[model samples]
Target: MINVGLNHFLIVSGILFSLGLYAVVTRKNAVMVLMGIELILNAANINFIAFSKFGNLGLTGQVTALFVIVLAAAEAAIALAIVLNIYKTFNNVNVDEIDHLKD
Candidate 1:
């Protein structure tokens, strides 16, 4: 059996990115889009940690990944608030029909 290594992490990240892309492309709901963004961020974090642990990239990669996770949480909170506001304002969360405020 092939020993798991950085390649495994890369493969997982690639799969995650693909899934996120599909979600973003096929989803019509704003919340689903947010979920896809979260998945993408998580995949990046996975790669960061993997490189930090297995490669010569040193500790900075892990530190950066930690910051990314924190920022992702903050971003998720703010984005959710905005989505909630949009839902309250429009009574729907569809992404393609909210272009009326551009006057």
Candidate 2:
């Protein structure tokens, strides 16, 4: 039998955050950057839920996590819309290639 603890959650969150950061920094595609950002947000939610559970913080963590989910959704929608518009305007979705919004 194995027991999971706060440390395990923290480690998972840390890995997620690191991966997200890497993606955001290294990825040239706009969509991939957004995905990385989502990963970072998820890592945060995991931390919040884990702390809430271990610290007996009741619904606070869960509520915060819910808010984060909503925020992430909204962010993704708006960002994807922007990316689409950028794609339409520039015909390219690479963040590095699109240097200027106006010509």
Candidate 3:
């Protein structure tokens, strides 16, 4: 039987982080960048919970993860709103093209 441990969680989290980074770096669409940011936040949450469980950190990790979830939701809402505005003004949601604040 393979015992899943902290190392396993860490490895998975690392992979998620890398994927998030790749998406953020390579994607041109604002929505895709937001998704990548979400992925990064999720990866961090995974690490927090995993460390909390393995390091005997009580409820701190779980509580922090909850807070992070709430923050991520709020962030997504605000970002999407801004992206919508950008799309309305520019007719596109590409991150690179929306370079200036002025029309």
Which residues of candidate 1, in runs, are more than 4 Å off? none
Off by over 4 Å in 2: none
Per-residue lDDT over 1-56 for candidate 1, one digit per residue giving the tens place of the 0 to 100 score: 39988898899999999999888888989999989999999899998899888888
For candidate 1, the lDDT comes to 0.89
Work out how many backbone clashes candidate 3 has.
0
Model 2: worst 10 consecutive residues (lDDT sum): 1-10
Cα lDDT for residue 39, candidate 1: 93
* Candidate models: Cα lDDT each: 0.89, 0.95, 0.96
Candidates in descending TM-score order: 3, 2, 1
TM-scores, all models, native as reference: 0.90, 0.95, 0.96
Better of 1 and 2 by TM-score: 2
Clashes of each: 0, 0, 0
- Using TM-score, give the best candidate's number: 3
Instruction: Name the TM-score of candidate 3.
Output: 0.96
Q: Which residue pairs collide, candidate 2?
A: none
Q: Pull out the clashing pairs in model 1.
A: none
